[model samples]
Target: MLIDTHAHLNAPEFAEDRDEVISRARENGVSTVINIGFNRETIPTCLELAERYEFIYAVIGWHPQDAKDMTDADLEWIAELTRHPKVVGLGEMGLDYYWDTSPKDVQAEVFRKQIRLARELKLPIVIHNRDAHEDVIKILREEKAEEVGGVMHCFSGSWETAKLALEMNFYISFGGPLTFKNAKKPKEVAVQVPLDRLLVETDCPYLTPHPYRGKRNESGYVRLVAEEMANLRGLPYEEMIQITGDNAQRLFRLPARS
Candidate 1:
């Protein structure tokens, strides 16, 4: 079975048919999914889905774009949510200068706070970075994130950056972008990332793989991403499934022993 380690099943886009989406993912061989919570308002919904679905897990934290709006109480509450049994990670959090939706300092502050929260809880983190490579690496290094390693979700950086993250004891995750014809960087990272440190995600309801590019995404399409990786690495489909599935289970500490 495969796993889409980063998805937003609770997003408003899924409000009308969340059950169908999850069912499709399961029917398509998705054994598990980590539903990431990014806003102050989404934590309850994220956890609710996790509670309802046996294969769903939760990762609670604020997104960098939403950083400017968070309150001290929100951060505190997020820390508290980490106490829940099914919540396994701390973020989809990191630097994003592509849009600069949040001020740099505010984003940095929120990122650091979430890092601290992850450290305190001793849980893995799922990072989202877009066009802010150097600062992201600097912060992860200075913050000493090795204490509790994590994955760089939808990782779009270079082999150098992927190497840096792996050195810091983090996994490299990729999604639909890897299937794009114009995604040179993701393609390079796919070929370079070690099989063990590599992971697959759908980022569903956001980054649908090619052929479904402009359409709304769902966890079931993660198979496309895995197939691309398998073809890129010249490995058999079954081996890719086992390796990537094992990588996800190990990274998220999924219930079953792989």
Candidate 2:
């Protein structure tokens, strides 16, 4: 089986056919999914989906783009949701300098707060970073994110940055972009990162892989990521699925035997 470690299955794109999208993922051999919460508005829906779907799990926190309009109450509310039985992690949070929809300072401040929250709650984090590697790395280190180790979703960084994150015990997760012929960094990260410290995701409803590059994405496409990982490691497709699936279970503390 495969696990799609990062996905926005709760987004409006899946609103009309959400059930079918989820069904297809199961039919395609994806046993688990981590639904990401990118904003205050999506928190409830993220939790609700985890409750409604046997394979769905939730990660509640705000994305950098969504942080501009946030308030103290929003953070407090997310803290409250951290106690939910199905809330396995606390983020999709980090920096996104490419589009400073939120000021860099605000992003850093919120990122630090989320890191502290994750530690306080004893849940891991799911970070999202883009063109902000330096600040992201500094904040993560300063916040002592290693204490609550997590995955770097859609990780887009040089091998050096990846190595630093790995040294901190963070799993380097690849997404659809890895399958793109032009995506050298992710492909390079694929080759360098060890299988145990490596993970695969669809980041669904976005970054759809090659054949489905311009199409709407779903968790089912994670099989493509698994195939890509296997190709990178020269292993059989089945092994990639098993290893990454197990990695996901271990990272999220899921009751895999259950």
Candidate 3:
């Protein structure tokens, strides 16, 4: 079975037929999905979905873009949610220089706080980096994030960056971008990321794979990302599915089959 390690199924894009979307993913061999909570509005919904579905898991944290809105009390709230059995990790957090919705300093502060919280809770983190690779890597290292490593969700970085992340005990996750025709970098990184340190995701409701580009993405489309990765690695599609699924299970500490 394959795993979509990062998704946003709680978004309104899935409101009409959320059940059907998940069923389609199951039909296409995606057995597990890690739904992310990016802000205060979506955290509860994200956890609710995980509670409702045996194969769905939640990663709750604030996004850097919304860093200005999160408060210390909110961190406590996230900690409370972490006690739930289905809440698998923390984040979708990190730097986002591309948007600059929040000041860089504020984003960094929030990111570090979450990193410390994840360490305290003994949970993995799911990072979201955009146009701030250097700062992100710097902060992660300074914060000693390797103690409780996490996945760099929808990674769009150079092989050099990936090498550093792997050394830091983090996994490299490829998403819909891996399937884009012009996405040469992700393909190059896909070929080099070690099997044990590789993961696949859809980041659905965004970054739809080619042939379905510009449309609303769902977990079912993660197969296209996996197929692309398999081709790049010169491995069979099923083997890619198995290895990536295993990677996700190991990172999130889920059951072997889940």
| TM-score to native of every candidate shown | 0.97, 0.98, 0.98
**Model 3, position 50: C-alpha lDDT score:** 93
Ranking of all candidate structures by their TM-score, best first: 3, 2, 1
Q: Is candidate 1 or candidate 2 better by lDDT?
A: 1
Worst window of 10 by summed lDDT in candidate 2? 249-258
Q: Judged by lDDT, which candidate is best?
A: 3
Model 1 whole-model lDDT (C-alpha atoms): 0.91
RMSD of 3: 0.8
lDDT of 2 by residue, 1-258 (tens): 688999999999998999999999999988899999868678889999999987899999989988788788988999998888888998899998888589999998989988998889888999899998988889999999999899988888999999889887799999899999999878887898988987999998999998899999889999998898899899999988888888888899987644
RMSD per candidate (Å) reads 1.1, 1.0, 0.8
Residue pairs in candidate 1 whose N, alpha carbon or C atoms collide under 3 angstroms? none
Q: Estimate the lDDT of model 2.
A: 0.90
List lDDT for all candidates, in order. 0.91, 0.90, 0.93
Across 149-190, the per-residue lDDT of candidate 1 in tens digits comes to 999999988899899999998999999989999998899889
* Candidate with the greatest TM-score versus the true structure: 3
Give the Cα error of residue 231 in candidate 1, in Å.
0.3
